[model samples]
Target: MDQNLKIELGKQGVFVTTIQELYNWGRRSSVWPMQFGLACCAIEMIATTMARYDLARFGAEVFRPSPRQADLMIVSGTVTKKMAPQVVRLYNQMAEPRYVIAMGACAISGGPFKQGYNVLKGIDRYIPVDVHIPGCPPRPEALLQAFIALQKKIDCQPLTGAERPRFLDAGAQGEFPVPVPGGHDLEPTSNRGVWPVPITMNRGE
Candidate 1:
């Protein structure tokens, strides 16, 4: 081959390799989460990203405070009617390929607050949702599992077909399923005027 032709082929090879690497990187880092913590479920959401569960193991630990920089928003608690507009604004601010995970029964379908006049029955009434984590306060593991489910859905999403899989299905029937890890059944912890022990961050001061 001529010297000039060889050099041109080498440059083209380098360009193709760089583009391929960038494409892979983008896919790996596609889901950037906006940390929109609202109530109890927020603690579980933080735990998922913390040292124990470590959401970073799956490339989803990037928790951006600004919606403009995020592609996923984990709505981690009850969204009241008063806050509906703000939620919509935040969802709109996110870049394309955005996703929302309603990270509690409250966010998914108002949880125990479904009868409240002030609380929004479901987040889907306003903005689109991608995953729904069912629990009054779901465990960190469950949230991480939901993240993985979200990733799978994103991967299998059709480019030109109908929109992505929606987490909430208003037409679906029955109560949200509660996940019981370690084969433990959920038992009510309190009785009338009896308070349960507060969850401590550490054992002692």
Candidate 2:
């Protein structure tokens, strides 16, 4: 059974896995999540990572404080108009092949907060949501399930997953744009390029 169970490095004994396999394995094994928890659901997310739940077992325990180091984002609560821009910015900063888990009903569909004029209907409105855990404030067990689902989704994706990650996917062709607080509501920033701002005021100069 040892023959079938273990890998054989034929001669030098120094040989092991290939570079790409090793790289991919490291990525698949250690999914560092960005530090982002918004509302009541954030508490549940913390519990899921604590002793009893131990999200570390699935290789996603290292919750990074910096978006630059993270590849996974668990949007664990409500997304209001004011917070939507910040959320999308974080998503933009994350590396390619990044995954998002819309945890709890608020992050998924705004839950009870949906009726509030300030609440964003869904996080999907700003960034692509990979998994959605449906509950007003989903339980720790439910968050664990979301991780499993995310792992499965990651496994199915190509190694070089996203095509032209930052710019192209941000949808220059009129899709979701980073939101900004303007007047009484949020305004999309994609059209700012076309705003008639003077390159240089010449006549008086």
Best by lDDT: 2
Best model number under TM-score: 2
On the 0 to 100 scale, the lDDT of residue 203 in model 1 is: 50
RMSD of each: 14.9, 9.9
Instruction: List residue ranges in candidate 1 displaced over 4 A.
Output: 1-25, 161-205
Model 1 scores what on Cα lDDT?
0.69
Query: What does candidate 2's lDDT look like per residue over 14-126, in tens digits?
Result: 44555555655676688888887999999999998999999999898999999889989999898998889999888878866677899999998779988897888778766
lDDT of 1 at 180: 19
Give TM-scores for every candidate, taking all chains together and pairing residue i with residue i: 0.66, 0.73
Quantify all predictions' global Cα lDDT against the true fold: 0.69, 0.76
lDDT (tens digit, per residue) of candidate 1 on 78-161: 987667667766776776657778889999888899888667666765555778899889999889889888877666553333
Q: Residue 88 CA error for candidate 2 (Å)?
A: 0.8
